[model samples]
Each structure stands twice: as C-alpha cells, then as structure tokens.
Target: MKTRWIWVLLMTASAAQAEEPLGCVEVTVGGYKAPNYDCLSQQMGNNPEGAAAAQKNMEAMNVPVHKRPPNQLGLATPAATSTRMGNTFGTSVKPQRPPN
Candidate 1:
C-alpha cells in the first residue's frame, strides 16, 4: 500500500511537469542565462540594468520589438487618410499645398 502511494505521487509529479509548457530553449541574453526568452525578459524588465542588458541582447540579435501602449496591444487597424498621396509627377496638374 505504501509503495502504491509513492508510485502515485511520483506519477502525479511527472504529469504536472509534463503539463508545463515545453519547447523552452535555454538562452543567455545580455549575460543573463534563463530557461527561455520569456522568463529572461520578464526578470530583466524588473530593473534598469537588466532592461538595458535585454535591449542590448535584442539589438545584437537584430530582433528588436517595440514596446506597445496598453490600448494598442490588440490587433489594430490604421485610420483612413482623407487623401491618398499618389504620384505627383504622374498627374498633369501640379498639386499645391494650402497655407494654414
């Protein structure tokens, strides 16, 4: 009975670990080593030094991501412009800017 309980506990522990997100690659960015980029970024974001290091790592890798505003986090559609700036030289009449 005791062996059965131990086996059950071990199985449960293994299952829990298996349920965790996989495919996490070990990365050393900005001299900080972590299991994955997400963890590294989150930890690094806590301090100015870490943030700078993370940014440096990102720049070195040439994969910089711009920080987005909270409101702009979701999928966004661009606002429509009143006039499309078509080729100016293509038109016969030259366009003139109106003074404010």
Candidate 2:
C-alpha cells in the first residue's frame, strides 16, 4: 500500500510538471522576475480579439448615464434648507449688498 501511494504521487507530480504555461516569458528587471504580459498575451491569443471581446463585455455590463433610474431618497439634492449662495457657508459671512 505504501509503494502504491508513492507510485501514484510520483505519477501525479510528473503529470503536473509536464503541463507548462503556454506563454509567460520571464522578465528580469532590478532582480525582480515577472512574466512579460505582452508576450503572454500574444502566446495565449489575447491580442485584438480578446481586447474587443472584453470591451464588448464591459459595454454590455455597464448602465448608461441616461438610462439609470432617478434618485428615490433625494440624496442627490442639497441637504441645506436655504437656497441663497452665502447661506452655504453656515452664517460664517453674510452676503454683502452692492454700494450705490
């Protein structure tokens, strides 16, 4: 039973190692190694078609400004009761009258 389990583990490990990433050319910059996105995109076939598909998907998911529903709770309106311009400051400075 121990030998069978060991054999199965080795086989699974080998199988996992056999499957490598299609793209992913590692880029080294300042001792930091990361996958080159451009190369990966090209290798994985995400150049133009993928971008277009993504854009279309985003557009489909988005709700246009004009099509959105009105604010039911009136949160969009100003909280202050006074409509005067100077009243916006909460009595910090009174609105001055023009001198004749």
Candidate 3:
C-alpha cells in the first residue's frame, strides 16, 4: 500500500510539471523590448504564423532607438570609430611637460 501511494504521488508530480506553461523570454533590440519569437512559438505550441504575427505586433508598438529623431543636442548619432585601438591605462593620461 505504501509503494502504491508513492507511485501515485510521483505520477501526480509529473502531471503537475507537464501542465506548467513554457517560460517566455523578452529581449532588447535597438533599445526596443520584444518577446523572443522562439520562446513565444514554443508557448503557442510551435505555431509559426501566430508567433510571427505576435512579433510583428510587438515591433509595431515601439519605434527602435535608431529610428527616433535626433536629440536636442544632436547627440543621437553614435560616434564613428576609425581605429580599433581603445584608450589603455598608459595612454589615458598625457605625460606632464618636464618642468617647462
């Protein structure tokens, strides 16, 4: 009888786990937050069309960071980096002129 009860409890636990919904995740792109399509599709039972429509609706709701108008100081545009070398500790400070 104890063994049978243990089996029943295990089965019930597995059933509860199976009924739990899949975890959906969101991602930020171009300063816009959108639901992850792969996760959404899984949550929607792998329905590609439904996931696509949902993604479209989510994207339509917000303008991406790049598309927004420039700020008042025109600093919205990112600075261009022609050289890959970044400022290291040695180069960060200029050497003081020798007691000029």
Candidate 4:
C-alpha cells in the first residue's frame, strides 16, 4: 500500500510539473546559456519570426536615458541695486513694518 501511494504521488507531481507554463528554453552555443526561448531560437535560426518578435519586445522594454548638458546649472547674475529704500518691494507704497 505504501509503495502504491508513493507511485501515485510521483505521478501526480510529474503531471503538475508538465502542466506548469515554462518561461524560456535555454541553449548553450559558446559556453553561455541563451537568455530566453526567443533568444535561443534566434541563435539557432529555428524561427526568424519568433526571434524578430523577441528582439522587438526587448527593444520596447529598453528606455533611452537622456544625457544632461555639460554645464547643467544656469549662470547667475547680480541684481540691480535699489536707488530708493521704499522701492525695494517693487511697490510705491511706503514700506512699513507689519503690526507685531
């Protein structure tokens, strides 16, 4: 009975494994495993359409990084000195301290 149970469990496990979806198929050409099914198929020339599709997908996933200018910051300039103290706030109204 124990042996039969073990066999049944093994069969169920195998079935489950077979039913599970696979992400990619790996192939080694020059001692390096191909990253994904598309890549492997591309290298092997098994499916040109599949390879092109995979390449397109990868390119879509990649985003170009915009480079900043050499001098990122803008140059600073000195402000004009106020001829009159009351004109400092850009208003003709006499400058007065707010109620404390």
Candidate 5:
C-alpha cells in the first residue's frame, strides 16, 4: 500500500509538471522566442533559408540569450583542435562567441 501511494504521488507530480505550462510568453509550452531581430537576421545571412526558419523559431522562443547572436559559424579553430585532442573550452577555437 505504501509503495502504491508513493508511485501515485510521483505520477501525480510528474503529471502536474508536464501539464502545467510555463514560459515568459503568454502562450503554450516553448511558445516564446528571442527578442533580437537583427541577430537572427545576421545568423540567417550565413544559413540562407534555414536561417529564416530558425529566426522564426527563436522569435517564438522569446528567450533573452536566444535573442542574441548564435554565431553558427565556428569560433576558434585552435580551440576546436584542442577540444578534439582533449576536453576543454579553451581559446584554441578561433571564434568562440557568435559573429559580431
């Protein structure tokens, strides 16, 4: 009986979390997007059609960081090489942050 109750409680909690929608937007789950239009536009410059779709998604996401440039382009080549050799977020990579 105790085990059953525990399972029921866990299930209920999970259900609540799943059902309870959350977001900075006033829509459903993951409904918000980034606020930066130019950032998305810049990123789109590199990706083409895909960038447009991504921009829409980001806009819908409404996240602060997402609003910023994603810099899809590689950062530091050296850093990437170093990472390949080991496990670190070093400066070996040429471009770390998104394109300015």
Candidate 6:
C-alpha cells in the first residue's frame, strides 16, 4: 500500500511537469524606436572616459536595459517602464523616422 502511494505521487509529479506542450509565443515591436543608441552614446559624452565607459558597462552587463524606475538599491536609474524576453526574430528593417 505504501509503495502504491509512492508510485501515485511520482506519477502525479511527472504529469505536472508535462502539463504544457511548450509552444512558443512571440511579441512583436510593430515599429518602435525612441531612444537611439548611437545618439545616446553621443549624448552620454562621446570620449574615452565617458562614451567608452558607457559602452563597456553596457556590453559587460549584456546590452543596456531600460528600467521602469531607478532601482531602490541605487544600482541603476529609471528609464523604460517595461521589459520582456525571448528571441526578437525578424528581418533587417530600414525604418524611417518622421520629424519629432
């Protein structure tokens, strides 16, 4: 009887893990471009001690992430209000920006 209970529990755990077939979902950025990297680098202070540091820091942390708000720990400042993950698969797009 104890063995039966154990087997039942094991099967339950295994089935729980297999609940989803693991399909993929993609989020498309229809046409988003606001904070430009090239321009940002220039604005941040384009030079050895300025732009270089920013570039290195960005790369070190694996691309700059826009924060919704400055971290309470004071590690980073607030910028973008949201974030997401997964592959951004798409073709090369040459988008145009109108007068702002």
lDDT of 4 by residue, 62-100 (tens): 645444333333422223223333344455446534459
How does candidate 1 score on lDDT? 0.61
Model 6, residue 56: displacement in angstroms?
44
Q: In candidate 6, what residue range of length 10 has the lowest lDDT sum? A: 80-89
Cα lDDT, all candidates:
0.61, 0.68, 0.66, 0.60, 0.60, 0.53
Supply every candidate's count of residue pairs whose N, Cα or C atoms clash at under 3 angstroms: 0, 0, 0, 0, 21, 0
Model 2 TM-score is: 0.28
Report how far residue 65 has shifted in candidate 5, in Å: 40
lDDT of 6 by residue, 12-52 (tens): 99999877433333344667544445545554553568767
Residues 1-100, candidate 3: write the lDDT tens digits: 9999999999999999888465876878999999877767667676669778989999987777788666533553332211222333235444334354
Residue 9 in candidate 6, Cα distance off native in Å:
0.2
Order by TM-score, highest first: 2, 3, 1, 4, 5, 6
- State which candidate, 1 or 2, has the greater TM-score: 2
Q: What is the overall TM-score of model 4 with all chains considered together?
A: 0.24
Judged by TM-score relative to the true structure, which candidate is superior, 2 or 6?
2
Overall local distance difference test of candidate 2 = 0.68
Output the lDDT of residue 39, model 4: 49
Off by over 4 Å in 6: 21-100
Write down the lDDT that model 5 would get: 0.60
Q: What is the Å distance of residue 68 in model 2 from its true position?
A: 1.1
TM-score per prediction, in order, is: 0.25, 0.28, 0.28, 0.24, 0.22, 0.21
- Which scores higher on TM-score, 3 or 6? 3
